[model samples]
Target: MKKKHVLRLLAAAVTMGMLAGTASCGNANQKTAQENPLAEEADSAQTEQEHESAEEVDMVFRGGTVITMLSEDDTDNTAVAVKDGEIVYVGDEEGIETYISDATEVIELDGQTLMPGFIDGHIHEPGNMMTEKKELILPEGQADLDVYKKELQSFIDANPDLPIYKASGMDLQAFPDNIADNEWMDELDTDKPVVIADVSSHGNLANKIALEMAGVTKESTPPDGGKIFFDEEGELTGYLSDAVSLLSTLPIIEYTEEDFSSAMKEFQELANSYGLTAIDSGGTIYETEDPNQYEVLSNMHSAGDLTLRINTTSWAGQPLEGKESDRLIKLLDDSQKYTSDFLQICQVKFSLDGVPEGATSALLEPYTKEAGQEEGYAGTQKATEEDLTAFVTAMNAAGYSVETHAMGDASVQRSMNAFEAASEANGGTPDGVINKIAHVNLLTTEDMTRMADEGVIAAMQPLWFYYDPFFSAQEESNLGKERFEQEYHIRDMIDEGIIITGSNDYPVTADFAPLHAIEAGATQQSPYEGEDDDPAYIRNPEQSATVYEMLQMYTVNAAYGAHMDDIVGTVEEGKKADFVILGDNPLTCDVKAISDITVEYTISDGRIVYQK
Candidate 1:
């Protein structure tokens, strides 16, 4: 017998408890048919008629666990049928046979688990492509400054003909005061401009030549929501915070349409391998100056080349004042031409504050003494609350959702306030609008309730729940032990009825695996080997969520956040046939082993996109 057939028989036997009492089973079967002979005959006739009337499907999957993601209690589903890119039937193995025919392609799960294809609630899509094409991406987790210098010099030497040099992924913790200066980078190259972006992408360190090229000097004023650092002697230190406007002046690589198309295709395949069929491009749409970026995506979608559904956004620029807000609305309106089933541009993104690692995130209280701040020093906000409210109101009224980058408690509160004011202004959040606050690293209990009441979604990165080696110390110093420990109240927020979604914030987070995120969120500890053994690696255990909850964050909640809930997120009839078949059931496995689960197959639009 085939292995699949044997496994099916065994599964059936176990389900029916065939070994418990054969005589009892025979007695029950005999009683059922004999006691109600006419009823049993009617049931058989109904079954035959139903089978004859069943519509044939294109694909059928059985002999495995099916997670519908419809509810926490939905756990018994084991089969699915699909036709014309939509799920036709979702039920038990016997029910799936109704839709099967000789021509139907049957996929034997072989005791695996099938669930909705993961959705990244927040990620930078083409931004990674642009970085790969324009800059030298440094190795992640390199804490040595000398290594960066060496790598930068080597990259410059190899690409001598380039007009300028650019590198990213500099660990801020490796620098003095978590800030870089021009001296060492200037030592690498003096003739050509060189700009190095910190790992967080919230800060940048430019060499003397790059600073000069950008016309930045000691007297130059930084743009709103940005900071240009100076030394004790009042010399430009080449450190910039949230200052992309000035950096754009430097010459960089220009990628063509074909380049972007190729990069997107590669990214799609990579995402599919990770069981991702959809992603919300969180504000990286304007990262590059390429005007044809959206066009490239639209072209691909029109040509049926896109394997991933993308919810794209436009970057709501800094100083989101009245005029700027109006400009953003008009930009989004103009972008409506690109809207399609595979590509959507109905969201706008803006940062309300910087990150805590840089001691720039706006906080409600003062930073600790170790953070190098004055006794009562708090952080700063990008725009005034009035401006933020106005911007949010404009976006909401224009029939779009706003996604804010809010890290500190103050920022989160201000974002909520703005969202609330926007709702009031727009008469209840506009229909179908789902405002989001991303990177809600610090939030108060009151605000959690407020977020739930106001229907605001939290776009969170689960990987940040753990006390990872990179930013833990900085965050602790910046927020103090009490506040730091209170951060990332994922479970609390979820319990308060606030919808939370998961994301890796790709490019920002190099490791973009949902399984890794699921494990980290569940354990609230570092997923890295030998790291979780240290107690410090664990964050607030109470805030840790279950593996199934993390899955919901990546699937159903994310689909709602992206406004794709109507067609995806759950494995149900009439929904898109997007699913990932895993080697093991994450819900039933040991929490620590969740990350080790392999994606055996990824199906999108009723087509097998990946198999392993």
Candidate 2:
């Protein structure tokens, strides 16, 4: 982005000092009786009634630097009033007091920084947390492969009464040699089937018995989007990939309704602790054709166990086995029965490609050392362009938004092409529709222009902007210098007018703190500053955004991406009372310490959900 525009935005924030309320809902500035004289009488009567019943208000928060996120007109030293489950007032302290009474539960923030509740724009709470709760989860990074085997053995022994053994979160990269075959796991537990999944959740390591349980043999044919690996002797190595891994685990692992509910509760608590009022389940359904997770979320909402607002997309292609479009529409339509202020089913999700590490993400150019490919191997496209375009067009015609996982430049380009086709077929994005492309890890200049022109939301993970020591070298080699520098070109998107939003694809990155993402985004470096201070660690320094810009990505922009901007993005009157209080102002804090600043309180639906 331009330095001039950056300074102007910062200047606007500085000018907002101790100002008061703006207009409610859409308008930025409050309209006076002189401006709208026709409603003067009703406004006066409503104000009088509000004052008469001030004591009935639910909660009042004061003595804080409130970042209303009201464009460039937000202010500090403001107080907010909540009644029922909505915000009634966001103004100066004295102005807020008029709506407060003895019955109001008042919270004195003492100069804390208050802003809209954070939103994890792209997360997979259902399958990830459900699996974590039901199965054993090994740590993310383990230098010793034996540690995982020992833990698996201990877990199996401890749960001797149990029927099956399942675990996830193993680092395959760290111990590739050990997982070359199932011999190590077979030595541990040959009788009881044992299945341990890699951290990516796309592959699994199983013992001989587990393979048999899943009905996999040397001659077994892998399903669509799946892979079954074998040794040189044509013997099953018990390594399953992609859709096959998901299908194989179903035989040994069980996800009961109660297990799903418990997992949702666990995930909600974690999100609440991080001050997340809402999260987008980037993809919905278990594998495909199974809305078990959705049913659990619905039941939880009905039982009032749901605390975070959830917006999810229907999964496409996989596990469907050629039945994609029609079933997807039915699932989207059925989800409306469970829709509410806290839960929504909005988008149809498609995976144009996979991740770069797996050499599955479709790329315009070839990878330097892509596995199972010739010298000039570009990646693979999971779906034909015609099929993808048709799906997008069909979903758009049905009035449901679309979002695709596009990691490689080729996938990103094709995804844009699909959205463009949808827009043209539907005569442009209809009202209340916003298409999105998740994980835009690589984007060309033409792709950027098309994204901005079509208003495609860039749902990005700022935490992924930095160079990961484990894979940066490989990534660099795969894309050479010209393309390497363009990796995660966030500022380019911003400059091009793309509505970029933030997320922390939870299981992929252990923590889902928006503050950590903001700090990482600003510096384009490690959140832990001292640990990796090398200049080479910076991915694209010039592309780093200001802290203020990062905050918008977390709040308003994120809400916009989730189709919740009209309700919860900004601290506006008539919006939901979802906001968080921080110990320090991130806008003015030492950039490195932004992550260190704690969430002092998290208020959701006019009630305190978390406090520290």
Candidate 3:
């Protein structure tokens, strides 16, 4: 419930660095050649002969239960052969042995299981990169208003000279009115500018000084696609959503290029520890006039600082900025400058709607009036239908996919309609791009079928598929009981033949472990074993997916979603040598035990990057 829980999970991930280091592996390989010089000449001659006779490979992994994830024919005891960062062979030991030479590094897998490295389909690079920095003050867990005040005060006392004090991770539900009251914030610190962000990161609470510092007044107009709140007396309530929240918070915190690069490294390392070979940075936006995340990632990839693959989609900016066709087209054209094996720009992303928790999602039907919202409120849409359709059509015609943030049924329907029309207008489905919709928490049966038929990818956060009283209790008020009870139908999508991929949407969720997501998808239950397990909290038991099905969503399906399937999805010939060695086979192990399995080794680009 708090950011501390996420940090704790990351703390555990840091320990995974103890897995054998890549440096040690290289050193061992080098030592083998230096130990003996007298026989080196003869060994070299013999090795050359063997290399000529055998199709020389750099590494060979054998003696394990290998789940190729390609098909049944390629499963079980499959030895993998890698040469120059690409898999040369994946078959029975007898067949793969033909490619192994004297210089090949042989890795004995023992009884462990080997599978494709996890691909997190959706996440944010900025938050994941900046969590450890002191600029952001994070509370331990579900803290009340008093706890937040104490923490904020402590932060102010530590950095008293800071011109602006910005802190995120406050649970809005803990406030008296379920929102950070500007009056309460002012009481805490009247002198310093204070802007506390909601846990969702889509909104923030600004004190009077902070609001004044941002030049916001009762007569001030908020940027497009954002909202500024006020009380009955027309006084600023200090709450800002979307564009306004970003505008107020980002400028106050001083972040340098070095900080961003360092954060990227940390994010990559943690992901490697979890056996992730690639991650799709769902979307990244900057407060600066020109976003530099593309440059930062490119520099890292060029300098050999990037150890995992990064696929990014440029943010479409605030919706009110008008149609940015020219700017977007230029950005896409510029994407050609950094296309590499480690990094690439893939799509454009736009927030079609807000979240349901705040009653801002574009729902087809009105929400229950019990939540204190207006009688006919169906939430707000960031852009008009005409603009959305035009944007999608333009992007698709340009050979680029667009990932839309659609959480409600109405938003989903509109997005799907745009995609369908664009595809039809283009004379066929868009090529070289996988159109995606993030967080389809609610959807209609017909739309779900349409999504499947159109091949639109579902970038889902299965970790959010928890059925708990604390969350379910707010369903009727945010959404009617009927819709609330039918949320996140995982099994239903699988049955509909939709291409689904599992993601963490990190910084929002504490954990991004694929095993946890797989288990949650199969059970439609919470992963926190220590938390509430009441049967009454189950969201939809009948929507449970099969373990194998969920595994596909995490691995091969995820790779397909990212358009990296040709290079690194399954353990097969001519693919990148990326494999995760696990303590137990997730497919054969007890379903509940999947999340308990520890990663033993993570091999990327023909090298053992992580070993347990």
Which candidate should be chosen as best, given lDDT against the real structure? 1
Model 2 lDDT per residue over 472-581, tens place: 55456556767767777887778777777787676666667788788878888767646346776677888888788788787777776676665787787678999989
What are the per-residue Cα lDDT tens digits for candidate 1 across 179-275? 5677877568549988877777888888888887788877787665567777767778888877767878788676677877888888888899989
Q: What are the clashing pairs of model 1?
A: none
Candidate 3 regions off by >4 Å? 1-53, 72-74, 215-236, 243-250, 285-291, 320-323, 532-537
The Cα RMSD of model 2 versus the native structure comes to: 6.5
- Alpha-carbon deviation at 533 in model 3, angstroms: 4.9
What ordering of candidates by TM-score runs from best to worst?
A: 1, 3, 2
User: Could you give me the TM-score of model 1 versus the true structure?
Assistant: 0.89
RMSD of 1: 10.6
Task: Quote each prediction's TM-score.
Answer: 0.89, 0.86, 0.87
Candidate 2, residue 535: lDDT: 71
Q: Candidate 1, residue 437: CA error in Å? A: 0.4
- lDDT of the structure predicted as candidate 3: 0.69
lDDT of 3 by residue, 333-387 (tens): 7766776767666678888877666666778998887544668877777877778
**Candidate 3, residue 529: lDDT:** 66
For model 1, what is the C-alpha lDDT against the true structure?
A: 0.76
Runs in model 2 deviating more than 4 A are 1-56, 126-128, 161-164, 176-183, 208-250, 284-292, 319-322, 370-372, 477-482, 529-536
Task: Pick the winner on lDDT between candidates 1 and 2.
Answer: 1
